[model samples]
Target chain A: MSKNLHTSAPDTDTAIDRNVPEFPVAQDSDEQNYFKTNQPPSYLDQLHKSTKEFIQFHKDQGKGRKVVLVTSGGTTVPLENNTVRFIDNFSAGTRGATSAEYFLENGYAVIFLHREFSLLPYSRHYSHTTNCFLDYMTEINGELRIDPKYSETMHKVYKKYNDARDQNLLLLLPFTTVNQYLFSLREISKLLNLVGGRALFYLAAAVSDFFLPHSKLPEHKIQAQDHNGGKLVVNLDPVPKFLRRLVDSWAPGSLITSFKLETDKSILIKKSNQALDRYNHQLVIGNLLQTRKKEVVFVTKDPKIEPEWFRLSDEEVEKGVDIESLIIPAVIKVHEDWIKNHE
Target chain B: MSKNLHTSAPDTDTAIDRNVPEFPVAQDSDEQNYFKTNQPPSYLDQLHKSTKEFIQFHKDQGKGRKVVLVTSGGTTVPLENNTVRFIDNFSAGTRGATSAEYFLENGYAVIFLHREFSLLPYSRHYSHTTNCFLDYMTEINGELRIDPKYSETMHKVYKKYNDARDQNLLLLLPFTTVNQYLFSLREISKLLNLVGGRALFYLAAAVSDFFLPHSKLPEHKIQAQDHNGGKLVVNLDPVPKFLRRLVDSWAPGSLITSFKLETDKSILIKKSNQALDRYNHQLVIGNLLQTRKKEVVFVTKDPKIEPEWFRLSDEEVEKGVDIESLIIPAVIKVHEDWIKNHE
Candidate 1:
């Protein structure tokens, strides 16, 4: 048996961070160097302008224009620069999209940062994975009309969507790779931070924890040709936990809420605690992979506070009710308290 | 560099194939053994039943019914059992989806085996990535109707979709993992095989060329904990080319058309020709990654035939015409010739 191995030398990555001074977040060595080394997304400037416009729109509406940055969907980690293939996390952005709608209903302007082609706020009612959009409309009297079966729910959704658009309360932005997501997160955090306690960071996106640096990535698509029974080996560096920077510097004075997803039951609360302790973020929502849609546990930064559980009943599940309906209002209360404390 | 190398020995896969008789594609050893080593998709039986019913529907209708299996979108290769991360190919199934619409229009029954949430035939008009459905609709006197801007085109698409449903001319089935796709392809191929030359195999799906065998995958999500600044390594085995088995056994008398996508212009035709030589399939369509939407070259199995270029003009591009509208007709013509020659 012949063996062919594809690998990268890790000695280069570990050698130390000697020259990291260009960006802020200087205390975190790896994350600070990440920006210096990697190229920002192509549309970073446009994204910044749009974000500023969203905040300014709220400011013009007079006092108490609370804005929430809703980061949704999963980020991909490309193995090659040309990217015929990439490592993707299992997420459809249901949590963030659902929460964004609820936030809007509660009169909070939303900045929806999402993965391309994942579910969105109003459109989630008629998702792409389910029945085709055409199925919901029937031709009658030379005009297409909404099917009576779906008209009631869709009409309500359509009205809400119109109100959102008319009020300019929703800003939709897309990111594909982990780098794009990270860079945009920084820009958004900085923009929202200026709004101070009026801003809230609802970080629900399923960010990849590992990524392959540009230096190691192949220029073209990885060839699948067998080299005497070959194996394609991919070495990925740990994606620096930028939540630290978000809590400490990026979005200071804002209520930062993040998620902790675990497959193991015993380690769920423990891991959530570690994140809260490490970043001292306002809240860490802990949920297991299998039951995330129905249940979640909130672990707060206050050491004396106990974890709180939130769940939906079987009847709610049968009725196709989203658990986010409960989750967002509770977070709003916490955010309200946060603003009061800071004031 | 303190390298924490994660690897698997290749001696395990390199040994001579044993116990491959159970599968019919035993003429090719690796593909036959692939089925033995891997578990069939959980829904394989249901998929088989559904596919058979589609074919039987055409048979029960009348004579001279031509059926085409249109496989679309990209298949994912899971890196772990719990599958927090997966290797995904970049495809939205535009070609296959667009071509299926054309096929149904040309009086052919289509079995659309597509990736979950990918673009569909009529639904491609309202893709999830493009615009929210609510954006395409309007309320007039408390009644929601298709927006006038999109009304004309959408009405046409809607009528065509209703025709498809009334006639039962289209069957839509979805696959996620590459294994599920492969298993379903084999079953669909055999079902279509009995129709002989009247059946056409349009293999447009972007299947992964490499996969991780279950023997090596981790049970849970790959942890991002830095082991002294650790690098995560993944080894993938080359996926065995199943075209050989598909042509020779699975769909013996069907017209097999496949696609070759390349980023490098220099190697495109040469590699495509190599595949033609290896598989002896009826046709291979070669296109570069950037130009796939506009231009493609048809490489036939016959050496005497020159490579044919089929491209849309700049005017056509400006008018928003799909290249598949042209490609599918040409393919249908080729299939017609194939059927006549066999007769």
Candidate 2:
């Protein structure tokens, strides 16, 4: 792949083509040094700083602690002309959020990289907490008047939120769009490296495959009427497969799981197998689109046991069943069994 | 599947089993009266009402128009305890909603069955058109600061929305779950039947595969608790393939299009071909997960011509390119070209 960099500085452009090693040596005097000079820190920078501090504090407290990284939601694609639009998907980010809760319950340190506009209750911030309560009350009342069955479901959700509040184990890094997801994942991976190899990555985000390859930062707003009757087209370059690459590049021999949804049974198996084969994943949970409850087939590289399919019933489905039921036990069994066999 | 209808009725020692034809008819006055007076309408009856109303309204206009139904979003699984949780993908419902706009723009009456919490803006109601001077000022200021490229893209979205508004050709059915989606699809299908095949169905939604079977509705609010430290197991039955069934049962000859997102080149071809084989769809568009822009391979069943792949550029990605560019033109060209050749 050619290194195509876009820049506006004329002198630097010439230097860039020459591939000068001392590119950073010449600094333009007019260019305001945002980082060098003391200025009020941006919200995002502050967030990063705080997160770093928290990790250090935790590291000081202990070793051999498990840190799980959970990523959720869909990424955004920038159309040509710099305007951004989101790729469409059916994910409300529910399963990812729920799984995060399960991880926290099991006493793992969590770093959640979530998407924008997720339906999951992310933070215990006062406003969000209040909204949750209101949602709970409204659901309770609505259920009471409507079918009692619906009411029962709402009650379970209410209880889950309450429990989450008590646990207080969530850390949220919210974003929208595919680029944001990629960047956040990379940033979190770096943080994990800083903290050591205790990181476990659960890639649950649904990333968009396409995006505008070239985008110009707009200085002014353009009107809808300006581009009348003219052809406007975007050339999309393929996005890098970050999840597959992450497992390969960052965390070797660490627990990594990926999800694949298929409409066909044979295809689902094929894809799950493919995920495991390509990524060296410990487990790949596959589900079909025909049903709402998860009936997953677990695929592992370990040759001792045959692949197992676990089906959830209606009763079990409503109880907010954790993927951990399958994930935890399988992981534990794999470790224990492997130890026994190897020893 | 065994027919087991358990009806709840007061004053009966046991639930009413409708499946047993030879069971003694217990004429409990309270139960019999309740069943007689307060029974909900049948699925078919509800279907008929919605279909008749839609068809009659369209026919009364005498526009000689076609109607298309586009269902978008993920469905939920209702557990036995009557609690419902969403089993969703990362779709924001943009394609479906945008396609609805396109159909309306081209003078087709559209019934858009959208899932809950989609980011796409619905057809604007008159009430939302505020004429505040401050709003205009804010808009102008926002436009002034727009990036040129982004402004261009915004112009297109605005133009499309305006054109759709002027055309007044969209109808919406907001939905959130698979059951609701199925119910709505069936209703629209009936309406299309009434229209004498002037309807096209787009199976664009990322519908989930598994659903809760035989879950009871909750009568009261349930508290959240971790399942007791015993292994919690669930059993899931396979859900019937509704999309495949729709293609087979309802509209055999209607123009159909489907999508397949693949991670690898080989699988992309395999899945695209499989979709065509299973549903006999007119067109199947395959996209790769690594592609940044919409790089699609179009496949058809015709033996003479091979499939074509369109590689879009970054510029084109910004203008919100049409899926029909690959689907509609190919469909029209194939049918037309085939007719000429045959003649």
lDDT of 1 by residue, B158-277 (tens): 999999989999999999999888888988999997788899999999998768776666666544332243445566666777888888888889999999988887767776887787
Q: How good is the docking of model 2, as DockQ?
A: 0.01
Q: Rate the local accuracy (lDDT) of all candidates.
A: 0.82, 0.49
In the order shown, the candidates' DockQ scores are 0.30, 0.01
Q: After superposition, which runs of candidate 1 have C-alpha atoms over 4 Å from their true positions?
A: A1-27, A224-226, B1-27, B224-226
Error of 1 at A171 (Å): 0.7
Please give the RMSD to the true structure for each candidate, in Å. 7.3, 23.3
Q: What is the TM-score of each candidate against the true structure?
A: 0.91, 0.43
- Measured with C-alpha atoms, the lDDT of residue B125 in candidate 1 is 78
- Per-chain TM-score, chain A, candidate 1: 0.90
TM (chain A) per model: 0.90, 0.66
